[model samples]
Target: MINYICNKWKAIKRAKNILKNKNKIPPYLKKNSFEEELNYKLWSTKGARFSASHRNHTLNKLSSKSIGYLSAYLIIIGIVNLYDINLLGIKILNNQVGFISTAFSVLILLFSQLESSENFSLKSERYHNCSLDIAELYTRARFIKNFTINPITKQSELLQISIDYDAILKKYENHLPIDYLQFQLTKPEYFGLNFIKIKWIWLKYYIKVYAIYHILIFGPLLTLFYIAYLK
Candidate 1:
């Protein structure tokens, strides 16, 4: 058992921690074997699915917040117009606020439509459930490897797990390549990623997942502040 654990930590030197030490568990396979490939695929796919689920959750949150900001800005505009404040001259202020509020109303309407159409909350749930199913398959694979005695039976069980993995993929929308890359970053040891590579992975992931949301949520607020400053 000790040997198996040590070899497990050591033998996962291949890209994405390919299982080279079949002797520890299955005990009869060579390197670059089917078991190695299946192990990597199951682990990587599970990670990507979970990452995608989280990305969608963030998207939902940002969209909701954008709407809230627009609503608040509109209310502020309403309150400002109630008085005869003329920080930028009353006529100029009126024109600017009118244009800004009209634009904000359009944005709020568009964001509301997108909130329903994108249905990010539902997509997030689906991705999470898919990941959970994949995790179950991964556990079963590990169980078969560790405990099963008959090599032929073990191969059959692993193959079935692979098949189930395929079926699960077919049932759900495919995750983005960026999502898989995000997964790889999560397991730096598995992918043999260095410090710089890890940072690059995070950079790419944040750019892909959060960049647009930042623009959507923060851009308008910044613009509101800019307009206020101008006034």
Candidate 2:
């Protein structure tokens, strides 16, 4: 796995090097109006932000789902053993539970392996970093547009902005473009709530999905223990 990761990183570096050597501002940008250049920078920054946000969302969701499933499976096994109860009154022997747990373990293992192979988390982080870099360039361009009036100075600054933008693009040229659906999902409305509110919502969501599963799995064991203590 280490070797595979190393190779992938090396390949990405090689591609970036090649792109840097060949990078150039688009022809249209060579003589574009200030307004046109600003618009382009704004659009490019938005695209990068949208892509980064979508990838981050996907990575988070996948992680939550995988962990939830594995946690539920383990909790169920522990509860059944601790209580010595036939869950749902369905007779299940120790060996049968072992088999079931092993099957689930295998499934989780395969999922983890697949996720690692695809490197979705790594790619998402990289895209997010690229977006931040592009945003910085966009801010600089906006500042230049607002403050600079001399045509020659404006042109020189704009050219430099284009070069910087191209450099960032070349470094992340392999990043997949955000699809229409992803773009829609990443709209501000989806995360427009204040930070505290958003975190509360996420907390409730995880509790409903994962915490409930835990309670269901462990409730019987606790109940059994309580009854024995009462006796």
How big is the positional error of residue 22 in model 2, measured in Å on the Cα after superposition?
35
TM-scores of all predicted structures:
0.78, 0.54
lDDT of 2 by residue, 34-88 (tens): 6576657555565656565555557556565665657686668767876787654
lDDT to native, each model: 0.81, 0.64
In model 1, the Cα lDDT at residue 3 comes to: 98
Candidate 2 lands at a TM-score of 0.54
Candidate 1 regions with alpha-carbon error over 4 angstroms? 1-30, 86-92, 224-231
Residues 81-161 of candidate 1: C-alpha lDDT, one tens digit per residue: 777455344343678778878987998898799778988899999999999999999999888879999999998999899
> Candidate 2: where is the Cα deviation over 4 Å?
1-38, 50-54, 78-83, 173-231
